[model samples]
Target: MGETGTEEAREFAHSIGPAFVKQYYTSLAGTSLSRHDAFYGNTSSFSCNGEPSILGAQKIKEQYVKLGFKEVLVDLEGGTFDFAPSHNGGVLVVVGGSMTFAGDKTCPFTQTFFLAPD
Candidate 1:
C-alpha cells in the first residue's frame, strides 16, 4: 500500500476497532457464531498464546466453538487496538484485553486479525 492508502487504511481500522470489539464480545455472549464469522475472511489467520496458527475462517470458528464458553464479559477499559496496513491490501489489527467468564475466572488475551475488504 502507498502512503496515502496506508493512512486511509489506518484511519478506517481505527474507526471500526471499538465497534468490532463490542460486536465480538456480544457474539461471545450468545450461542450463534455467524456474527463472529462475519468479522473474518476465508483466508484470515488466528493464533492465541503459543498455540499453532489456525488458518481459514471455518477452522477459526471451530476453534472458538471448542472453547465452550457460554458467556464472556470483556474488559474494554483494559484493552488496546493497534492497527496497520498489510502488504496484501488488508489491515492488520492486534488487540489485547481481559475477559471474565462463567466461573468468575479471568484471562488476558491477545489476538491478531488480518481484515480485508470483501
Candidate 2:
C-alpha cells in the first residue's frame, strides 16, 4: 500500500473502534439483537469469556439473545488498531473496557476484531 492507502487504512481501522462499541456493545447492553447483527458479516466469528468461538452471524445473534442480560453498560478505557497482514490486509482492533451489569457488578473486558473493508 502507498502512503495514502496506508493512511486511509489506519483511519478506517480507528473509526471501527467507536462504531463497533456503539453498534454492537452499546446496543447489546440494550438487548438489541438486530443492532448487534448489523456490525457482523455472514461469516463473522466471535468469542469471549473463554467460551467456544461462535461462527456466523446467525449463531452470534442467538448467543447474545440467550444471555438475556437485563441491562449492560460498557465503559471503554480505550482501544488501538493495527494492520493485520495475516487477514489479507485487514485491520486488527483491540479495545479494553469494563462492563457493568444490572446487579451493579463489573468486569474488565478486552475485545478484539479483525475488520476487513467491504
Candidate 3:
C-alpha cells in the first residue's frame, strides 16, 4: 500500500531470495509450466484473457494453482526483468517475488513465460 512498506518488503524478499528460488523450483515440479529461459523481443506478449499487459494481474491463476502456490495476497512485493532471447523463437521472462510478492511477481501476478513459435 505505502511506498516505504513496499520498499521494506522488497528488501526482505531479497534477503530470502535463495529460499524462494528453491521453493519455486520445488513447486515447479508439480505443474505443466516450465520456467522461461529465452529472450524478450520474440516472445508473445503476455495476455490476460486477451488483454495485453506486462503485469498480468490474474493471467496465470490456473497455472499457479496447478503449481501449488497459495493464491497471492494483495500486498506482496517483487520485481521483474526481461531477458534477451536466445535465438529467434522464444520469449524470456524473469519474475521474482518479494516478502509478499506484491510488485510484479505476485501481487498484480505474473510468471516467467516463454512463447516459442510453432
Candidate 4:
C-alpha cells in the first residue's frame, strides 16, 4: 500500500482511465453481461441511482441482467476523469455519458468505478 496520492500514481490513473472506459462500455454494449464477470467478484459492490447498494458483484450483475437490454448505445460525454488515486494502486474513474436504449430512447448517466489492481 502507498500514501493517499502521488504524481506517479496520478499519471498511472490518467493513462489507464480512458482505455478502461472504452473497454468497459464497449463490452457492455456489444457483449453478454457474463463477459463482464472479470470486472467484479464476491468482494465487489455496486449501486445505481442511489438505490440501496448491492453488496456483492454477482448480485449487482444480476440486476443489470434483469434490465433485459439487448443493445445500448453508449456515448462518452462530459465528466470523464481520473479523479483520484485510492488505496494501493487503485484508480477512481468518474464518467458521465448517454445510454441509448431500444427505440432511440436515450438517458444521461454518470458512473464511478474504482479500479483496483488485485
Best of the candidates, TM-score: 4
Error of 2 at 33 (Å): 2.8
Give candidate 2 misplaced runs (Cα > 4 Å): 1-8, 68-70, 77-86
**For candidate 2, lDDT tens digit of each residue in 44-107?**
9878678898988888878766654436777865643343322455667666777777778887
Q: Which candidate tops lDDT?
A: 4
Clashing pairs in 1: none
**Residue-wise C-alpha lDDT for candidate 4, range 22-106, written one tens digit per residue:** 7877778864676665678788888887787787777877877765444777887664555677777788889887888877998
Q: Least lDDT summed over 10 consecutive residues: which range in candidate 2?
A: 79-88
Tens-digit per-residue lDDT, 13-64, candidate 3: 3444444445554544433333421222433344544554543324354434
> What TM-score would every model get versus the actual structure?
0.74, 0.72, 0.28, 0.84
Residue pairs with clashing backbones, model 3: 39-84, 39-85, 39-92, 76-100, 76-101, 76-102, 77-101, 77-102
Q: Write the per-residue lDDT of candidate 1 for residues 1-118, one digit (tens) a residue.
A: 3452666766776776666667777777676676777666777777766799888778888887776544666776758888776666556767888878777899987877666656
Question: Measured by TM-score, how close is model 1 to the native structure?
Answer: 0.74
1 or 2: which has the higher lDDT? 1
lDDT of 1: 0.71
| RMSD to true structure for each model, in Å | 2.6, 3.4, 15.6, 2.0
Reference-based lDDT, each prediction: 0.71, 0.66, 0.40, 0.76
Residue 36 deviation, candidate 1, in Å?
A: 1.5
Candidate 1 Cα outliers beyond 4 Å, as residue runs: 1-6
Clash number for every model? 0, 0, 8, 0
